[model samples]
Target: MDHSIRLQIEEREAASLAPYATLSRETKGRFRPEEECPIRGAFQRDRDRIIHCKSFRRLKHKTQVFLAPTGDHYRTRLTHVLEVSQIARTISVALRLNGHLTEAIALGHDLGHTPFGHAGEAVLDELYPQGFRHYDQSLRVVNILEKKGEGLNLTVEVLDGIAKHSKGRREILPEDLSELPATMEGRVVRIADIIAYVNHDLDDAVRAGILSESQIPSHLQKLFGPTHSGRIGAMVHDLVVQTLKNGGEILAMTPNLLEGIAELRSFLYENVYETNRVHDDFIKAKKVLRELYEYFINKDDHWEKVIDYDETTPREQMVCDFIAGMTDRYALDLYTNIFLPKPWSVM
Candidate 1:
C-alpha cells in the first residue's frame, strides 16, 4: 500500500511546528528498528503502542496518591497520567512542540508505579538488594517487560521522556537544562507531572476530608486559584506565556508561580502525604508487600505461572518485576490467598 499520507503529515509538521519542536519525521528511531507505518508518524505509533500495552491497562488499578481509596473520585495512576497528558499537550501545542511525543511520554510515565503507590515502591527499595525506582522500572516496562519480554521498541524521544519524567521532591526546574530531558516534549511532560499531581492530590485530599479548602495557604489559592480548573488554567497559562516570552528556547514560568507550586507541594507533604490518614494505610501496604516479596523470592514452586517473564532472568529481578506489575487489587488478593488462614468447609 502507498504510504504518501505519512509523508504529507511529516511535511505539515515541518511547516507548522516550531524550530525546536521534535518533528515526527526526524525521530531518533526506536530501540529495535522496524518499517514505518503507512499512516502514523513515529511518535504517534509509540503513543499507540503504549496505549495498547498490558501495563497501560494495569494503571487503572494502581495507586496514584490514595491507597485503594474507597471513593470513586480519587485519582488512580490511570487518571493521573491522563491529567498529565492533557496538561502536557496544552503546553506543547502552545509552544508548537510535538504534542504526539509529549502525549506518548505522559501516558507511559507512570506505567511502572507500584500497586499501593509510593508506599509499595518504598518497600521494594528497602527489601531488594539493588533498590527500586519507578522511572527506571517504567523504562524496564517499555524496554523489557511488555510483550512477553520483547518490549515496545519505542522511539528514543519517547524513551528519554519516560525515563526523566519524575523529580520526586527535588527542584521543579534546575538551572542546568542538561538535568532535564533531551527534547522539549520530554521537558513538558516533566513539568506537567508536577502540575497534574499537586493539584489533583490536593483535590483528593479535600475529598478524603484530610484537608479543607481554607486550610491551603491563601497565597497558593490566590496564585493558582481557589478551584481545581482555575488552578490548572493559571499554571498552564503562566507556563505558555513565560516560555513564549523567552522565545521558547527554554521552558520558563514566573518565579512567583514556580515558588507557589513548590510551596503547595510542601504543604501536601506535611499535611496530606505524611499525615496519619494516608501514612497509616501505607504502613499496612508496606507490610503486605514486604511479606509477599520474601515469600515469592524464597518459594518458587508456582510463581512462574504468574510471573513468567523469562526463565533465564534471576528470581529476584523477576519477582521485582512481578510485584511492580501488580495492581492494588491483585496484590491484595494474592496476599490474602497466600498469608491468611481459610476456615475449613464441606468438601
Candidate 2:
C-alpha cells in the first residue's frame, strides 16, 4: 500500500507500517521522500531495525546522567532514546510531518554513544589521534554494525540527520521554507536531546538531593518554571515555536535561550556530573575503556574474536565497535580481569 497519496493517513495506516522491521523506501538519492515519493514506508522499518539491534539493547546499561545500577529512577540511554522519540514524534505530528521518520532518527541517534556519557567519549577521542565521535559511530552502527554483518540500509536522509545532529555541525533546512515536513526533522531531535537532558537531569539532581530548584540562577530560574515537567514543556514549546516561526525551519538557538540552557547545563555539571562519586565512576570507566582499547588493538587474536573485520580495517573503528558493544558491567569485568592485579589462590 502506497502511503504517499493518502490525504492525512489515519492512525491505523501509521500503525500498519510497523511489522516490516527492516525495509526502506525505494526512493533514490539522500533526500527524504516527500509525501509524493515512490515506494512504500521506509522510516518504520528503520525504527524497527534499530529497536532490535544489539547496540540498542546495550543502551539499557549505558548512562544518561548517573551510572548504571545506581538506582532505577536514573535515566539510562534506552530511556533517553525513548523520551527523545516521544518528544520528536509529538512535534512531528503537530506539524503534519513524517512522525515515523522523525522517530527513527531520534531512536537511533544515541546508538554510538559510549558506556559513560561525554566522559567516555572524551577518553576515546584522546586515545585515538584521528578522534572518535558518537554521531559518526551511530551511522556506522546502523549501516554496518548489525544485521548478521549487514547494516539496516536505512534511508539516506535519516543517515544524514543522524551524522550531523551534533551542535557544531551545519544546520538542516529546506532550500525553500515552502516544503512540508521540513529538512531538519532530525535536527529538531538533536536540540531535543539537550532539552531532555537539561530538564530531566535537573529533576534527577533534585531527587538525588544534590541541588534545589531555589539554587538555580535567578536569571534562568524563571524559565526553569515551577515544576520539572513545566520547564521541559516550556523548553520544547519554545524550540518548536521558534523553529516554526522561522518558516518551518530550525534556527540556531537565540543567545538568551542558549545562555539559559548553558546555565542550567553548568549547574548540572557543577552539582551532578562533577561530584566526586560520579567523577570517580567516570574515571574508572575511562581507565577500563582505554585498557580495553589498547588490549584489543594490541592483541590481534582477542580483537579477532570480538571484531570480525580484518587488520586492514581501520584500527580506530575496530576498537570503537568493540567498546561500543560492551555492556557497562562487561566493560568493568574485562578491565578488572585484565589490568588489575588478582590475589593468588592456593588451589
Top candidate, metric lDDT: 1
**Model 2 off-target regions past 4 Å?**
1-40, 168-182, 251-258, 303-307, 341-347
- Provide C-alpha RMSD values for all models, in order: 1.1, 5.9
| Residue-by-residue lDDT tens digits, candidate 2, 1-347 | 45544324434444543321212332243333334333335666667778888888889988877766677788888898898888777766654456667788888988988887777788888887678898888887887777655676777767866876665322222233343222556656766777777787888878777788788777776765778777777776766677566665344445577667777777788888889877887887788788888887787553433337765778777777778767677788778888889999997
Per-model C-alpha lDDT, please?
0.92, 0.70
| Candidate 1 deviant stretches above 4 angstroms | 305-312
Could you tell me how far off, in angstroms, the CA of residue 63 lies in candidate 1 after the best superposition?
Answer: 0.9
Report the Cα lDDT for residue 293, model 1: 95
Candidate 1 C-alpha lDDT tens digits along 110-158: 9888999999999999987899999999999999888877889999999
lDDT of 1 at 205: 93
TM-score of 2: 0.81
Clashing residue pairs, candidate 1? none
Q: State the displacement of the C-alpha of residue 329, model 1, in Å, after optimal TM-score superposition.
A: 0.6
